[model samples]
Target: MTITFVHLESVHHKLSKASHKADPFSDARESGLDIRYATISDAFPLDHDRDLHREKYWTTLLQIFPSYVDEFVRKLIRSDPQSLHFLVADTVYVWPTAIARKYNLINVSFFTSPAHVFSLLYHLDLLKERGHFLRKDDAVDIDYVPGVGSMRIRDLMASLSKRSDITGNTLFKAFEEVKKADFILHNTVEELESDTLSALNKYQPNYAVGPINLSEASSVAVSRSLHAEVDITKWLGSKPAGSVLYVSFGSVVQTSKEVIGEIAHGLRLSEVNFIWVARAHLTSSGDSNVLPDGFVEEVGDRGLIVPWCDQISVLSNPAVGVFFDALWVEFGGREHVVRRSDDLFPSDLRSADGQEVGGW
Candidate 1:
């Protein structure tokens, strides 16, 4: 069957470049799958400009991308009518499954983060009961997560508040949407997060088809011509194993000045080689001057602070030992919980072709 990959406009640009680089045209064409990219064209206003907090951002996104949403529905109807549509976007925003059953298209929502993170987000109510969620400047220990041992409240992202505020309520709503998905696709391998994967399977069909390092195996000849600027693979090839800490907060998370300093200190104290992608501009309500004075200079050759970098290539490298980033409540926590590959494919589940039989 044909699969049309739908993503938000911004994500579409990035994923398209990555996909083309990963296979050129021959790979996608040979799979008997026609890969088509489409995006809803709308930009939600900044959170601060709208006077909305973190939670309300979701509601604002729904409003800003109404046309994109309508286009999604129309595209499915026009495409194959019976073909499955694979949607890979920030599930917090582009949840097409709400309308999937109505259109007879199977909606597969891909979570680039860990399943445990989504699990915690899904059980926001339970977290609230155990006092796991905390308000601004409030501290609490996160000891209830399925696989993660324990994390301090301050160590958690500020967005994990249990209060009945706009952000909290909106997040809870998003979890409801997650529950209705046809299947959940996580960008983490089974080797890293088994317990969380098992917990997720009890609720919905799940797949751990990642590290999602398709870009790592792409031909350099095709990639060089496809995109301009830096070669992240070259940089990663130079680092030592388990020495460099890969730091990024995806595309949406914004870190505050205080938290940034704290992170720099944590990295320094940890005494690990690091690569930090720190955005100068603030997309959300937070200060960007969080890095300590002379932080970059102090770290010098040991640390590289760039505005943006290729995450897939960097993460796939053997030199990079640990991945570090601020744990936004939206991102679950700092723990890197993932499932092992062997755990994902049980003997009974394998087809004659040796592929997993059940769809996820």
Candidate 2:
């Protein structure tokens, strides 16, 4: 089937440019989709020194999204539109999906997080109704989440659970919106999340066409929002091949100073060669001091910390053998966080084929 892919850049000027540069749609043109990019004119302009004050962030999203959806629908209407089979959109914004509904087109909810997380989020309201969510106090004794297994209440994704006045209301509205769609789309594969996917299918028709990393990156001229001085390639080359731990947590989640200090300290103690992507701006917010005193001095040349670098290129290098999410580093204090193969691989980790290495 022929598909036309359209991207709406709704962030402020800086972020939009970065996203367009790192867009993973250039390969679609070869596959036969008429790809398009639409920049939201009044989007919040994000910069190094600027703060997307929570209020302004949501306001801009509500503002520019309607215009973006309208423009996209206009293009669709002018083209072989009715021939279009489905309207798949991110779970956040509902305007485009609403437009699809008005046009009588099939609408599917596209969730970009792990399928288990998606399932937990989709059923969040049910949890609240059943009293599994304790709203009186943020601390509640919850044993498990719907599709996702035992996780601490604090780890419960903020988007699905209780949020502030504006954010909470917005998330619920979006959650309710997804239920109206024909089905939910996840950027995950059945092999990786078979049980979760099976459980989720009871709600809607689920199609898993992902590792989603398999998609080629955008060919459009792009830029990065992070600093440019770090030479990540050369540094990676200095490390023994496949000996570097690549640490990063995309743009959305920010680590606290305490967590950052703990991680830096642990890496030093662990004596593992690592490349860490630390967004300087995240540290700059609210606190003048973000890292532990003597963090750089303690670790010395063993760790390479940078504001940001081309992640795709860094991962592609043979020097990077293991992937470590900075969020996961919180679990580093535990005994079974990571082990080595033959002894270097994480001992408690199971092999992809299901062979037991170590049980957590």
Candidate 3:
């Protein structure tokens, strides 16, 4: 089967393509597969920066996304009426199922996040009916969500746990439509999330074939980073094995200045050799320096902070030890120390919900 990776073109990806920096699709070309590629306009101007005006950007995109998908699919079918087509989409988009049905294509909903998160989103109505949606009490246990077993309400992604905004509402709507998908694909491990996947499968044809980001070219390092990456090889290599802590909340996940300050203070107080991906758009307030005052001075040579780096390379590094998506909230300041890297896997590597997060 021919698989064409269709990218909803973004300004950052456009820049990356022009410069030939961090080609996310290079490995695909090198794989010698029947795979093809295409880019559809996200209906945003070339100069538009989504990070600068995130709310407006997403709100506008969500409003017009269905129309864009409809146009793209319509054109795709017109281009090749003879060839059979299967439409696979990220679960975040609301129009995939309808678009697929319109074009007589098999629709597949792919959930890239953890299956546990998917379970919560899939059962949004259950959460609402049970007074769990936007509940004030974070301490309440949420065991009723199918396959999720027992997890606290607060453990959910802030978007799921907290009050709903336009973006959140749109995301919830997308998940609601995902139920109509012909098939559901999760980028997760079946062994790890077997229960969750099994529960989801009862509703639809669900499959757990993942760590998909790794691709067939596992040895070849590739990054789809929109930001310029800092080469931390020399600095990271200097650190002893299992001594450095790697901290990043990912490209799009934003936190407040207060959370940033707390994490910074905790890092400084911990004094562990570390590399922190302090992306330029890490905060919504647009504060360039999210680090606390004297944070750099206090940490000095012990910490190497960067805008971004090739995450796969960093994780593969033997010198690197702990990886923290969340901050030092789990590990108290100065008191708790990460001694052995082995001690941090499977057990310590848990979501806020206390579920063991499977790694790539």
Best by lDDT: 3
Pairs with steric clashes in candidate 3: none
- Lowest lDDT sum, 10 consecutive residues, model 3, at 330-339
Candidate 1 residues lying further than 4 Å off, grouped into runs, are: 11-27, 30-32, 43-58, 64-67, 82-90, 129-157, 162-169, 214-229, 232-243, 265-273, 282-293, 316-319, 328-360
Q: Which digits, one per residue and each the tens of the lDDT, describe model 1 over residues 22-45?
A: 334445555454655445644643
Count clashing pairs, candidate 3. 0
TM value for model 1: 0.67
Best by TM-score: 3
Tens-place lDDT digits, model 3, residues 162-246: 3456667777889889989989999999999999999988999999879876644554434466666788999988888767778
Ranking by lDDT: 3, 2, 1
State the lDDT of candidate 2 residue by residue for 213-330, as single tens digits: 5545564323444344356888887877667777776665554565566556556655667788776445425464566788777777768877677777887888776666734532
- Estimated TM-score for each candidate: 0.67, 0.74, 0.86
lDDT of 2 at 273: 73
lDDT, residue 8, candidate 1: 48
RMSD of 1: 10.6
Worst 10 residues of 2 by lDDT: 332-341
